[model samples]
Target chain A: MSNTRMIELIGVQKSFGTLQVLKDISLTVDKGAVVALIGPSGSGKSTLLRSINLLTVPNSGYIRVGDHAMDFSSTQTLPRDRDLAAFRARTGMVFQGFNLFPHMTVEQNVMEGPVTVLGTPKAEARELALALLAKVGLADKAGMRPDSLSGGQKQRVAIARALAMKPDVMLFDEATSALDPELVGEVLAVIRSLAAEGMTMLLVTHEMAFARDVADRVVFMRDGCVVEEGDARQVIEQPSHPATQAFLSHFHNGLA
Target chain B: MQYQWDFGFLLQYKALIGVGVLYTIGFTIATAVSGLVVGCLVALLRLSHLRAATWVVTAFIEVFRCTPVLVQLVWCYYALPMLTGLELTPATAAFLTLTLYGASFYGEIIRGGIISVDLGQWDAGRALGMRRSQLMRRVVLPQALRRMVPPLVNQTVLQLKNTSLLSVLAVPDLLYQGQLITSASYRPLETYTMIAVIYFAILFPLTRLAHRLEARPGH
Candidate 1:
């Protein structure tokens, strides 16, 4: 493992019954780097993102964060509920659907994780939540419920909720896929600013332009394995792999 | 036909009607409040993670739902005291039967409310690191209750009508009192009409309120 690497995976494998979803996936994320995973639907982009937080455990893999390696496949290994819980505190994830608690006000949704997960005092958590909402430019909508917000604003609140935990690394699992076309740009801009601020991110996104513009590196995947990996500029233009070349050509020219 | 309808006899027994309406109103309110508490607890148990608790609550719901309220009322009023050697007056038996009957119906209503809530709400609560109890209190139940309002009002109306059945236990509720008045005055048509009018007055406003709540946005 490199000294500056924030996440390291070795021979990570996952399966659903007899069907394999992730096959011998090994990757490294350097500190403060944005890595974009892009591929066709059902190519395991979301699975790869979820596996980092153990939301979807791998069948056989060694996942290392900072200096700690948590083995997911061992039947004998036991990580207590609290231990797994504490581990999740360091990673923030934004879902495709903007899964805000409908019962809570926008401000309460952001404050929830800090107070419940981290046991921060209510007053302190409230302050931190407000600051995060301000960062996403949703401070004025704090008193409203998520149902009242536009799609773009809801996604921003979801982003603020994830950031409230003060995570070291953030994962975006197709965060803009469910949004309307016009709403996509606002969410993308917020994510772009996070990258500019040196936040480590692993995004599973369909936005080719975003991957090209903001990602330090891009991994092109097919059949649950990365077929081509390189700098975003090289992969998006002048790709070496036939799969990558064919996939990109389809979207660019309306011919698959 | 009733000896020229004996309109003055109707006027004479008006006090009895007033007291009867009070008893009916009091019983309905008390039972509805207690039934809500019973229903919520049983619903939670029915959805319990433990198999034993789930089975127990499921059996309870099934038994109460399938049996007629009349039979249950009679059993509670007559058989319970014999079996347990604990004597209860007619009012106590009527209250217990109402509580049990209302609970089963309300349990179904509450379960439907909980299920109608979006699945993502549960996932969001888990992601926020809320415990099962906290998730229910802060996220799931609030949304469920909001969705439950109309159905709860319907259940309460049904319960108010069901209170008339308690007359069999000689609880001196509205219908029982009405029967006593009619027997003395021999004016069933006039007495029953008054009782019906009183029930309409209580239920109509609640029905309208439920409709108004349902019409609101995000309801």
Candidate 2:
């Protein structure tokens, strides 16, 4: 693993019973690189994204992020809970449903990771949380509960919550897929800003235009395998693979 | 011929009835608290990955739930001493039986509440690098506690009513004192009517509180 490689997966394979979801998947993400993973519905995009943080543990694989590494095939016992938690603490994840803690205020939700996991003092965590919330354009919503926010506002809070952990890499699994068409822009704007700040991110997104504009590279997966991967503009505008061409045809007219 | 109603004789036994009321309320509060603690432990055990612990807790819940509270009180008071060779006073036996009986139902209610929280919420917490205990304390319990309030209150109310069965064990609860009043005064109608009134007075408000909690918005 090179110093520039922020995330590396080697011969990762995951299966659910008889059906394999990730087939010998090997990919590398460089530091400060934004990779957009796009594909059809059942193409294992979300599973692959979730595997990075060990949320959906692969059947047999090697996954390394930063200094933490786990090889599922080599170990008789699964990684200890403490080790897994420590590893996951290094990566931030945002979900499609905006799974914000409904019981806590937006500010508390953002402060939770730092105060609980990192053991940062409450006052310092509060300041950091406020800054993150402000960055997400939710400064006024600090005291409000998540259930009170709109889909767009909730997603922004979710983003702020994840970013509060100061993770090395951010994983967004269909972050904007569950939002209203009108609400998509606000969330996409936050992600776009994160990319501009050179945050290493892997996004499983259906937003073709947003991916084309913000991603440094595009990876196309189908049936648990990457069919095509190249420069974002090159792959989106002029595909070398026939499968990529067919997939891009559907979104051609919808591209903005 | 008209039956003349007389409530005047009961005034002489006011002090005794007052003591009975205090005993009943005390038992309810003590047992409710103990039951809740035991229930939480039971629920956690059931939720754990340990197959043996889960089976043991499930059996405990089933035994208490399937048997009648009256039978449980009798068995604890009478049969328990025979098996364990430790004699128990009426109050001790009643308290023990009620606490365990209440725990069985409370455990199920608490487990249901915890599981009712969305799977995504657990994922969200896990993704943030929270351990299972941290997720339960910081994420799952806070939300589950809201949905648990009404049922928990309702269960406590049932517990209060169940205290009436303590009379069979010769415990000096409200209903036991009422039986004494009936035998002494030879006025079963008035004594039973007054007992019913007192129970209603205590339970009506609690049931109302439960309803209000159930109707409360944003749960």
Candidate 3:
């Protein structure tokens, strides 16, 4: 497999008013690598994942994903809206809420990105959307509205919608966190298959076992910074940092 | 002699009433189309990040909505010609007032509809690499427009009724034509009753349609 830097964030910082969400964050993911970000709620894991696509631009930092790059501190070289749109196309985001255009059918939701952003022809986009929906195991539901889908099914469609763009990297912000316990499995299975196929993904997830199994590396975050990171097995099973150990204890006790 | 009934005279005035009805319907449709266009522009300006532009639109809506539509019609019909030295026919002045008046309400309804959409929808659009305009045209407008249907229909009915204000300017709208017939034939009771019936005939169905739209938001 050809390996190059797929994503890089250097000295990235984000704040909403006085509350800093991402503080001096620096990370890099090689092409085709999956990095799982695990943390307690409000620890900024999701914020960091969102910043990858400039969904929430950092207050100050340098970010580079593929050919797109931005130095937030520079006054003159700020990326234009078109540049940001192109960059976001390169790094697709799947939200926890699904956020599918409710007025559209499942097929339209899946095909929307390509038709509008890439200007792909209707026939080609339709074919790709159907294939992606099939990949997510919801090919039969393509004609239905988002309101009719199960929570897990909606998230899967959202994943397929993001994938339809054929992005260079995918970001999932707690994709399965909102699903009913019974429904979580189906969505995870699809994500697991994506991992198995060597898709580059960065996910903020609460499903510790799924992360450990699927992610090549896990980064534990606390209070807007990465406290620890290593190979997924080493980090999740035996942590060297006290913050990581403390955070894992809650999950360990609950699961055990 | 029982004050001789005069339903017979209306037969002679049917052409006038026909032209009047035509003008009424024409004014309503014209106001609606132009109002929608103006409303969208003002609504976008109100929602924009520009503080000064939003304040100006806010003032415009506030001014239109606070006063009676009569005040606006009178101003456009009377004061505007003096101040701007621009001449307008009485019917055109009525059209101008009705359009601006309807636009203020339309702008509010549109702004409300757009704001009510789930905030997460914007995130979905942005994440997909769509531009701001594409996001609005494709995602946000479709959902927002569905929700806006009831309010928009309600505004249309109200606007239709407000067109009667044109009678004051003697623009030969339905009410003005009825007044002319009543004066010429001295059959005020029958003439005004017929006018009332005609107004109800035009507007009652529209009100019912608005009710139906309100009841079934999915439509």
* Decoy 2 TM-score against native: 0.96
lDDT for model 3 comes to 0.90
Question: Which CAPRI category fits model 3?
Answer: high
| Interface DockQ of each model | 0.30, 0.76, 0.81
- List clashing residue pairs in candidate 3: none
lDDT of model 3 at position A49: 90
Per-residue alpha-carbon lDDT of model 2 for A110-195, expressed as tens digits?
Answer: 99999889899999999999999999999999999898899999999999999999999999999999999999999999999999
As for TM-score, the candidate ahead, 1 or 2, is 2
> How much is A33 displaced in model 2, in angstroms?
0.4
DockQ value for model 1: 0.30
Per-residue C-alpha lDDT of model 2 across residues B1-219, encoded as one tens digit per residue: 987799899999999899889988999999999999999999999999899999999999999999999999999999999999999999999999999999999999999999999999998999899988898999999889889999999999999999999999998999999999999989999998999999999899999988988885664
Compared with the true structure, the alpha-carbon lDDT of candidate 1 equals 0.85
Ranking by lDDT: 2, 3, 1
Off by over 4 Å in 2: B217-219
- Cα lDDT tens digits, model 1, B68-138, are 99999999989999999989899998898899888988988998899888876765665555556666787
Q: Please provide TM-scores, in order, for all candidate models, with all chains considered together.
A: 0.84, 0.96, 0.95
* CA-lDDT, candidates in order: 0.85, 0.94, 0.90
